[model samples]
Target: MKTIWITGASSGLGAEISKQAQSKGYRIVKLARSFSTSKMENQNIISVHMDLLDENQVMKTVKYLSEQGLAPDVVINNAGIGIFKTAWDINQQEAEQIFRVNVLGMMALTGAVIPIMKEKQSGHIIQIGSQAGKLATAKASVYAASKHAVIGYSNAIRLELKPFGIAVSTVNPGPIATPFLKQADPSGSYENSIKKWLLDPTKVAERVVRLIETPKREVNLPWWMNVAAKAHAVAPHLFESIAGPFLTKK
Candidate 1:
């Protein structure tokens, strides 16, 4: 059975992805800080303690997997933290933490796994990016920047690892109905405004799990938002002028 490693599996989309993937008969290795306290090991699933912020712990976790003959066939970099606020309103620590967790932490874990993947010449790395990375909006400057880095990094490594038979895929979704929204926007204004359009976490998780079988360079959720992101890319100023009010909802 193919082994799948998922970060941030304690809750949200990560947890749902783990559940769906396991149902398909894949062995799951869940990595999360929350797992540091709980023992969730079974024949089909193994939970390991991991805090993306701590590079040392990340290396140790990877080593533990390797020693146990559990080197994953796929690694999903799904752990991320976001604090949504206007550019000026966000403090230095908040900005640093967002980038550290969303970008650097993901990069560190990917870096640790690449050597093993290259040795086997087979693996898949999936990153959970954001639509904000493609189309920037108001009040999410740092968060958007971090996701933009994820996409950029993923794109560069996709070409680098292709000849080695390693696949890189990115799943970029718009706002999802998850605890993420609650943490990112505590005031609930953004959530309330986009209530009708929030992507279902289960559906998003399904797509992510499916990507393991049919790998793609990128997957964008909710076709309409993908269209808008593409349009914005082609004509940034025009799209902004047209959707200024809507974009500022966040």
Candidate 2:
């Protein structure tokens, strides 16, 4: 059985992925701050209490897992937070907090695990990205920035790790219906159109499983999202002309 380690396994996409992976017979290690895989948990499942924001605890946990020879065939960085706020409305502290969990924390854990995988010249790094990573939108300014960083970082890591026989991949899903949107702005300023298009977390999880099994360089759900991102990139003026007005609501 392949050993897989998944972060953010407590709820939403992460939790669904953990369960689905479990059903597939992969020995799973689920990491969450306060949740457990105890219900269906067994020796094949190890739930760890992890706070990615705490470097000391994060490093310690990695080291301990390493010492136990529990290296995984794949590590999924699915733990993240989303904040929806207009650029100016979001303060410096809030921006840092978003990056701390969504960006830096993922890096810390990846840094901890890469060496072991490198020694064996085997492993996969799966990052759960978003459509925002491909294009910037209003209100979700800071949140989109972090995800955009993830796309760039994942691409770079893929190039760097390819020669070592390690796979680096990311799944960018559009408008996922997770706690993210509900907690994003908290001011309820997000447009109604986008919210109505939210995709189920399980649907995203299913795609993730496909990514894990096949090991694609990168995958994006909802074909139209990729199309729109391209248009936004190549024809920014036009994209903004139509998209900008609706995105920024009072």
Candidate 3:
């Protein structure tokens, strides 16, 4: 059976993916800050403590996994943070923390797996990005910036790793009903505004599992959002003027 190592496996999309993938018969290695083996009863599940923002802990965990020699067939970089605020309102420290988890932490974990995958010459690296990465909105400036970095890094690494037979793919999902969103928009205003667009985490988890075998360069869920993103790319100022009001409000 193939082994899949996923970051942020304690909750949200990560937790769903771990449960669903394990049902599919894949050995799952779950990494999260507070994940406990005692809480998990599945024989296929292995819990590893990991804090993405802590470089030292990340390195130690990577070393331990590497020593285990159970080189995973897939590595999912799904740990991330979102801060919804206007660029001016987001303090310097808040912005930095966002980058620390969304960008730097993602890269650090990916870096740890790249060497092992390169040697194996066969593995898929999946990045969970955001629609805001492609289309800028008002209150999510820092979040958007971090996802932009993720998308860029995923695409660039795809080309770099192609020769090694390691596939890199990115999933850019629109609003999802996850704790990340709830924390980012505590007032629930943003979720209420986009309630129609919110997606099911279980559905997304299934997509990620299927994509492990059918590797695509990138996928933007909910075709309408993809269209909107493309349209925004074509005439950004126009789309901004149209969608700016709701997106900007906190």
Candidate 4:
């Protein structure tokens, strides 16, 4: 049986993935900051409460799993946060907070998992990145930067860890309707437009589960986001010209 450890399993994509993975008969270890007894009461699931920002807590969880002889076949870093305000609007402290949760926190957890996977000489590491990683805009500056870092981190480790039979892959999701949206809403006119474009969190989770279940480099979900990401890449200036105004507050 394949076993995978998935973080961000409290709700939204994480919660959905945990349940669906169980149905597919893959034993799951679920991690999150705030969990509900109602959500993860299944024999195939082990729930670990962790604040990714806390490196000590993260290390202990992985060490515990290893000692239990249940080191995972895969580790999915899915816990993340996004703040949509112009780089300056959010202030330095807030920006740092975003980096801590979205970047450092995930890295800390992955750092804990990789060595165990390396010792086993086989495993997959899937980082849940964002389409924002591929493109940059006014308000999403910090978020895009952090996700861009995920892309770099995953790409570099893919080959580095390959020698140990561990593969690193990332999923760049465009937008997903989750409780998180309520927090990131820019309080701008485009709110409805932005919400409409979101992919379902459950769908994102299902895709992550399947991608890890098999062997692959990376998978981009709701595929059309690729077009937008690339359009920005090829002609960032033009893309910015069109996206700048609406994306920024007047």
TM-score for each model: 0.98, 0.93, 0.95, 0.90
Give residue 31's lDDT in candidate 1 (0 to 100): 88
Judged by lDDT, which candidate is best? 1
What do the candidate models score in CA lDDT, each in turn?
A: 0.93, 0.83, 0.86, 0.79
Decide which is better by TM-score, 1 or 2.
Answer: 1
Over 1-250, each residue of candidate 2 has an lDDT whose tens digit, in order, gives 7788899998788999999998898988888787532233687888888888987877987887777666888999999888776788889999998899889999999888888889999999999988889977777788889999888889998998999999998988887776666677566545255666668888889888877789998788788878888888899899889977644542
- Let me know the TM-score candidate 1 reaches against the reference structure: 0.98
lDDT of 3 by residue, 94-205 (tens): 9999999999998988888898889888899999998888877888989999999999999899999999999999999888889988889888888888888789999988
Each model's total of backbone clashes: 0, 1, 0, 0
Model 4: residue 140 alpha-carbon error in angstroms = 1.3
Q: Candidate 3: which pairs clash? A: none
lDDT rank, highest first? 1, 3, 2, 4
Clashing pairs in 2: 84-184
Worst 10 residues of 1 by lDDT: 33-42
Q: Over the full model, what C-alpha lDDT does candidate 2 score relative to the true structure? A: 0.83
Error of model 1, residue 126, in angstroms: 0.6
TM-score of 4: 0.90
